[model samples]
Target: MSNERLRIALARSGHTAASLAQQVGTDPKTIERWVNKGRVPRLRNAHAVARVLGVEVRHLWPTLNGRSEVSGPVGSDLVAVYRQRSDVPIETWKTMFDQATESVDIMVYAALFLHEQISDWNGLLRSRARAGVRIRILIGDPACDAVRTRGEEEAFGHGIESRCRLAHMHYRPLLGVDGVDIALQATTLYNSVYRADGEMYVNTHIYGMNAYGNPLFHLHRMTDNGLFDAHAASVDAVWCTARPLTGEIPDGSD
Candidate 1:
């Protein structure tokens, strides 16, 4: 009944039919049809186009639910979007354990969420690692240039670095545990990423801004090559560049 969603999305992204078509790898006329007639693309292409346009598919087609409205050539999976990192449910964050089969990976500047949100996480990881789940966590090095720059930009002074140090304390319990790897990096983290098998939660970072306010994406593995892979690769790249936080980590409590 309404087509303003598609109209608004195009306007917000500043994407024209030609530009969007080029990014989505579709015909310009196809985009024209979407804009002029409010036609929706197939599930696979819808996700492709949404990623290109930097939006949730539902933002373009507001009337539909991703589960019902989309069905990929391979499978129907969602890439849920949130306006803020906190918008995602706690259960969704915890559900990573349920979904993870082979590994669990996280890359963040300071994982205050892990410290403040979850309870008894050390015991939880002990159980998971004992069960053969390989866990790797990467946090920012407090003394690194990237942290210093970010601290100044956020106007938090040394607060960001302090948080990173606090995060190391929270993770101290897992320091020597088998199958758990913790590292620190000086990389310029443009996005905070967390991955559990095929699903990934990513939050984009804005200049001089905290990560919480940035738009977050919970991308499910709907295709062989999609946003999930891109994010996973990013985590791997950072991991390779990072220095392992080896040896005994001092156990500091809250």
Candidate 2:
């Protein structure tokens, strides 16, 4: 679609119209015409533009993609793509975290409180790191060192030193790393995880709807590229200015 508003969005997002056009394999004048003339290109071109912009193809066609289609499982309700969280099984979380290859961003108000379950998660991180996954952790100030120390101390006690080490981890606040391609935000009050793949997300919230009062909400497989991209943007905005945690070992002893 050739809309000035879309052009503005692209400009504000650190992308130039010409670069975007080149990425989508379109001429600069074509992009200029679309922005200045409010012209809607063919569906295929629109999709190509959306892909280049890292947004959903339907962003240019809200009527079709905005509507909520069958998402999530039985029980939990579908609340618009940008809002609802997917309360999936713990196993699924592990699987998804394990599969994360390119980037991993997590924002948590509380550190991983399940230190007893540290081995599996630590192993996952180490394995991912070894495989070259860019991993980042964001935790509230009050919980940052407590979590790091707790996890490491626990690991030491169990003779699992390397697995629990946070030397390679980076800690910052929610607003410090906005614009990151893929990220997750975890809040204790309402535990939610936003796992992004491209612009789509497999948002899983572990909150109120667990099997036996466990802190798992419901699971939603949202394919809305626009909404997912928007969420990722929001997280990045918050992460951009948030505090950065330095000195991995807390005591500066490595």
Candidate 3:
């Protein structure tokens, strides 16, 4: 009955009103009415709607004790995970991400600069750093230049540059003499989507899991486990001596 809920569900599935109607075996006009005229579908129709959209029946009927409406804690395994060909849902992912404790380390071959929401994630990472959660990023050197010139001594242009500047100012340490918590690293061929929060780790495949082209993969779970641990240690070592991105380099010779 919630119009917004129905609309969001449809958007998530990339459904057109007409396509949705055909999928549910309803008339397109009826779906149009439900979406625009604020008409709620009947129970039988709702089931059809949910079924065709690959959504839970409870999502359409909130009062039906629908377990799908519940929001679990961040570290919780979801009741179901729906995979579609699009970027991960930011809002939902954030709720899960916010629950991370201890640390997050990202090793990526390439990263498109960031989404608008990423600043919040960056901030969250900073908070995690303060709380003793280690945060480390291993980003491709090529990707780094997209934001900042590799060896040039000036700040990148525009407002985003300021955000980049601030990131380094409050940046938490993953290593060095005073460092203990977070570590981040990068490799040119690394490409898997890896996230670890608390004891749970989820790896989403941008490339198929079986593909060996990605440098980011772990060979054996045990071997990779040790490697990741060692990688984290190395990150801590680098962060210790690395100048804060916000501050000018001491030599001023670069």
Cα lDDT for residue 220, model 3?
A: 12
lDDT tens digits, residue span 57-120, model 3: 5444444433343333321222233343132334444443454565565543223233345555
Candidate-wise lDDT, in order: 0.74, 0.45, 0.44
TM-score of 2: 0.39
Residue pairs in collision within model 1: none
**If scored against the real structure, what TM-score would every candidate get?**
0.68, 0.39, 0.35
lDDT per residue, candidate 2, 8-58, as tens digits?
447534667688787878888887777777666677788887655544444
Top candidate on lDDT is 1
Clashes of 2: 20
- List runs of model 2 lying over 4 Å from the truth: 1-87, 111-115, 143-191, 194-225, 247-254
- Evaluate model 3: give its lDDT: 0.44
Candidate 1 worst ten-residue window by lDDT: 69-78
Which runs in model 1 stand beyond 4 Å of their true positions?
Answer: 1-78, 247-254
In angstroms, the error of model 3 at 78 is 12
Q: After aligning candidate 1 to the native by TM-score, how far in Å is the CA of 122 from where it should be?
A: 1.8
Considering every candidate listed, which one attains the maximal TM-score? 1
User: Alpha carbon lDDT of residue 61, candidate 1?
Assistant: 61
